[model samples]
Target: MPEVKRKYVTPGELVGKGRYNRTSNVYQIEDKFYSTRVGMAEVINDSLRVIPLTGPYIPREDDLVVGKIIDHSAFAWEVDINSCFSSFLLAQSVFGRDYSPARDSLTKKFAIGDLVTAKILAFDRTRDPLLSVSGPGLGRINQGEIVSISPTKVPRVIGKKGAMIKTIENYSKCRLTVGQNGLVMISGNPEGIILAKSALDLINHEAHTADLTQKVQDLLSGSNNGEKE
Candidate 1:
């Protein structure tokens, strides 16, 4: 396998010249791939994707997201997933098939201002995304401090094969639940949480850097009692 390299790219720039097994944020013309926006172009193995430096989180099916309950209707609760489009969590999803608006109050399960970690059940260009909290580690975020970064930086935050997150969690003694939509829930001691947030900030600003994982490890390992410098 060839070594993967990430490069800054601009709109209409030629990203690659090959058949890719997967692609994102780039259009292909024949055997060439052209970037669709200003961002970082990455080619790993047979996959090619341009991680846009600036953009809203586009909803994709099965994306884990942390969202805020902004409003509620009779049928569903509206959640702000930090995207241009709001998402819906139906009452039936939480209350079973026989749920009733009068008998089963939506607010009872999730109220305004509550944060939840959910999965994008379904989404298409035609309708608002649907959410489900019916899985392991998915539901109202009752604890932890929330930290948000650019959605595009999520892949970098997770690192290659979970190295970055593992480093932070192991060194800082914090558990990080990162959302594809850019929201992060850091749960641990106060000091550990502070250190974790600092690491996340560093990753967000320096995602394009090649040695970011090492930098984050240094940041975590060098912190004294998890105090911010």
Candidate 2:
């Protein structure tokens, strides 16, 4: 396995000089790659990218997002995924191909203000994102406390190989589903949920700091008086 290198970088900083199979959030200057934003730069074997530390959520294909149903047209429901654009979940995605507006009422399935965990099916500069909730763990979010953080800090919340999230879950005894949009849905006892949220807040605030994983572990291990649910 090729070794990976990661470091915080500012815009215009030199990232590396080498041929890479994939590179993003960076511009190539001949064989050299330069950072395009203030964020974490990662060089993984043949791949390279900068994960921005602060930015609006940009819709990407296959992104798991937690969104709220804000409005609905005859054919699709508009979802606010905490991005510059509102995404649309088509009726055909939820209902069958032969769906009828008269027979299939959109509100019957998901009403306005309903929170949904969905995937981005398609997106481009020309149109708003298209979404789908027709898979395992996708659909209306029935219950759970939602906690939001900066979208860029999502990777930190998840931790290396999911170690941070697993640590929070193990210590707080909460089930957390994190959306790339920086939304997290936590379900467990009220006390556990409170504890998990605190951990998430810590991660969001100190994502750029060193030894973050250890800090999160320490926070989770400490006493947490349950907040009022």
Pairs with backbone N, CA or C atoms under 3 Å apart (clashes), candidate 1: none
TM-score of model 1 (CA atoms)? 0.90
Give the Å error, residue 33, model 1: 3.3
Model 2 lDDT on a 0 to 1 scale: 0.92
> What lDDT score is found at residue 170 in candidate 2?
99
* Cα lDDT, all candidates: 0.92, 0.92
For candidate 1, the C-alpha RMSD (Å) to the true structure equals 2.6
Q: 1-229 in candidate 2: lDDT tens per residue? A: 7898999899999999989999989999899999999998999989999988888889899999999999998899999999999899999889989988988999999999999999999999999999999899999998889999999999899988999999999999999999999999998999999989989999988898889887777778884435321
The CA lDDT at 133 in model 1 is 94
Summarize candidate 1's per-residue lDDT along 1-229 as a digit string, tens digits. Answer: 6879789999999999978999999998999999999998999999999989877899999999999999999999999999999999998998999998889889889999999999999999999999999999999999999999999899888988988899989988999999999999999999999989989999998888878877888788884445554
Top candidate, metric TM-score: 1
Residue 49 of model 2: what lDDT? 94
Candidate 1 whole-model C-alpha lDDT, 0 to 1: 0.92
TM agreement with the true structure for every prediction? 0.90, 0.88
- Pick out the ten consecutive residues of candidate 1 with the lowest summed lDDT: 220-229
